[model samples]
Target: MSLRWKISATVAAVSVVVAVALSLIVHLAYARKQADDAHRLQAERIQLLLREYHRGSQPAFGSRLDDPAVPADLRAAVRGGKVATALRQTSEGTFIWAAAGTGDHVLSLRSDYRDSLGDLAALDRVLLLGSAAVVAGGTLAGIAIGARLSDRLRRAATAARHVSAGDPTVRVGAAIGGRSHDEATELAHAVDAMAGALQARLEAERRVTADIAHELRTPLTGLTTAAELLPPGRMTDIVQERTKALRALVEDVLEVARLDTATERPALSDVALGEFTTHRAAALAPDARVVVRVGTVVATDPRRLERILANLLTNATRHGRPPITVVVDGPRVTVRDRGPGFPGHLLRDGPARFRKGGDRTTPGHGLGLTIAAGQAAVLGARLTFANPREGGALATLDLAPAAGGEPSP
Candidate 1:
């Protein structure tokens, strides 16, 4: 059940329990007080009868008492020169009786308490109705309070979801009703603040990366030209290779920064999945095997798709064992490599730009997967990494379905 309903039910249940308990107590107290008043009236009537009998004015026993209704124990008490009272329930009704002795004969007086019994019954009905009304009102109030709290919680949850989905502009506090200084309001403000802080930090990081990449391009070009002029030696070859790798890294960083800032947009095109995978696999890694089970067409950016595939293949070759497999199934493309799979953290949080995975010994600046992921996002695709049951890292890119009546070939 939802939190709102649970809270409402719990509050309603407690209110009912408390109301029932209090009603029972009040009913019992009122019934006892009424019984006491009835008994006192009965005693007074008995005393009046004894006074009349002792004053030489004998009253009629038939008028004062019902012989059949009076018990034998009450008559014995009156004959023993002691006042006595008893409450009795008969087929006729409920009654309270009192008796006392006057001389040799027993002086007795009895009051039929069935009327007082009826009054107690009426009082019980009133108490029951009032208790039910109290419980109903309390339950409704609880439901209202719970609904209000649930609404605030839902607003906060929605704002959190928006932030997770890359829209940091959503503010839970502003979206909710009048601002109260309650814990829920404070939590909403916290969520908004967190989103703002994250947006600012990511923007700052993107700016720094873009700035560094832009600054390195000119010097890198000069260094490349200078290296070409050097002698064809081992050292020259090493410098050129390192320079090329550095240039590639800088370009990847710039691309990722653009993707982050929404400055990059995909140029969509229809491409045959099977043919595209085969050609890209051949051009990128001819040694790797390409398996196309479902030959279908997809509408996506060919450049971004190629980039994503190329990165996955490169990572497999660099870190994984041989016989890398690339499979294209409809809008899904999976690249599996026979390696120790991905590190636990990388698989969980995805590839972060410049954050190396596995051991630090791996020769990569970790921009390949990051660039691939960012490119996939731009193409409105989902890229997920996992390890298959057969072992090895698996990278799957799910693209949008084919458009323009593109049939499977």
Candidate 2:
């Protein structure tokens, strides 16, 4: 059940218990008071009868001489020179019987209490209705309070989700709606504070990375030129290959930092989706298969799209078994490789730079997907990764949002 419903149920249960308890107390007290008053009246009537009998005069009402209608227990007790009373439920109705001993004769007086019993029944009905009203009122109040609290919590939860999705700018703030010092308000403030702190730390890390990449670029250029000048031999070939790899790594670091800082702007242009994807995949991996199901035109940043595709293609070639397949349909491009798909952590957390799996056989750092996702964001596109049930890693790049509309296929 939802938090709102749970809270409402709890309040309703408590209200019902309290109302029942109060009704029971009121009913018992009223019944006891009425019984006590009836007993007192019976005692006074018995005394009046005894006085009349002693003065040699007959009492007018409720006076019985040797009444056989009295209960055997009451008759036996009263004959011992004592005044006693008993209640009996007979076919006539409920009645109170009181008797006293009078010179080998029993004097008795009984009052019909059925009317008072009816009054008690009416009071019980009133108390039951009142209890129902109290429960209903309490349930309604609980619903209102639960709705207010649950709404605030829902908004806070949404803001937390946005932060987890890498947008630290989203804040719950005072829009959550509650007293300034209330727990909900304080929770909103805490979420905003956490987002702010995260953004600060991310900015600091991005600045340091960008600075380091920029500093390495100049020396890498000189190193590339020096390696090219060496004699054509095995040793020179190794040096040039190593130099190229190092340069690529430095460039990737710089690219990721730029993506993180949101410094690169997408240069939108008209591109033929099928032709572009086919050509890029063939150039990157000549042995890979390129399939075009339909032809369409789309407007997007070609440079960024190429970078995203290149990273996906490179990751597939390095970590997966080929032949890779690149499929283009409308504004969507999908790259698939027959391999041990992606890891569970990658699927769960999306992509993070520098977070490579434990497989040392793979020949690149884990920035490929991160860079692809970042470039997709810059181009206003959606990129997703998954391990297909058919047993392969699949990367899909959807450019529909950025393309505005797919041109006629």
Q: How many residue pairs clash in each candidate?
A: 0, 0
What TM-score does prediction 1 earn?
Answer: 0.89
Report lDDT (Cα) of residue 80, candidate 1.
Answer: 57
- Per-residue lDDT tens digits of candidate 2, residues 1-409? 8889998999999999999999999999999898888888888888888888778756547688788898999999987678988778899988888888877888888889998799999999999999999999999999988988898899888878877767655788745766657888887888788788888999999999989999999999999999999999999999999999889889999989988876578888878888888888888888789889876777788888989989999898888888799988878889999988888888998997878766966777788999999999998889988999999899999885334555555
lDDT of 1: 0.83
- How does each model score on TM-score? 0.89, 0.90
**List of clashing residue pairs for candidate 2:** none
For every candidate, C-alpha RMSD to the true structure in Å: 2.9, 2.6
- Find the candidate with the highest TM-score and give its number: 2
**What does candidate 1's lDDT look like per residue over 324-393, in tens digits?**
9998888889999889998887888989877876578888898899889888988899999999889999
Question: Which regions in candidate 2 have their CA more than 4 angstroms from the true location?
Answer: 56-59, 262-272, 294-299, 329-331, 401-409
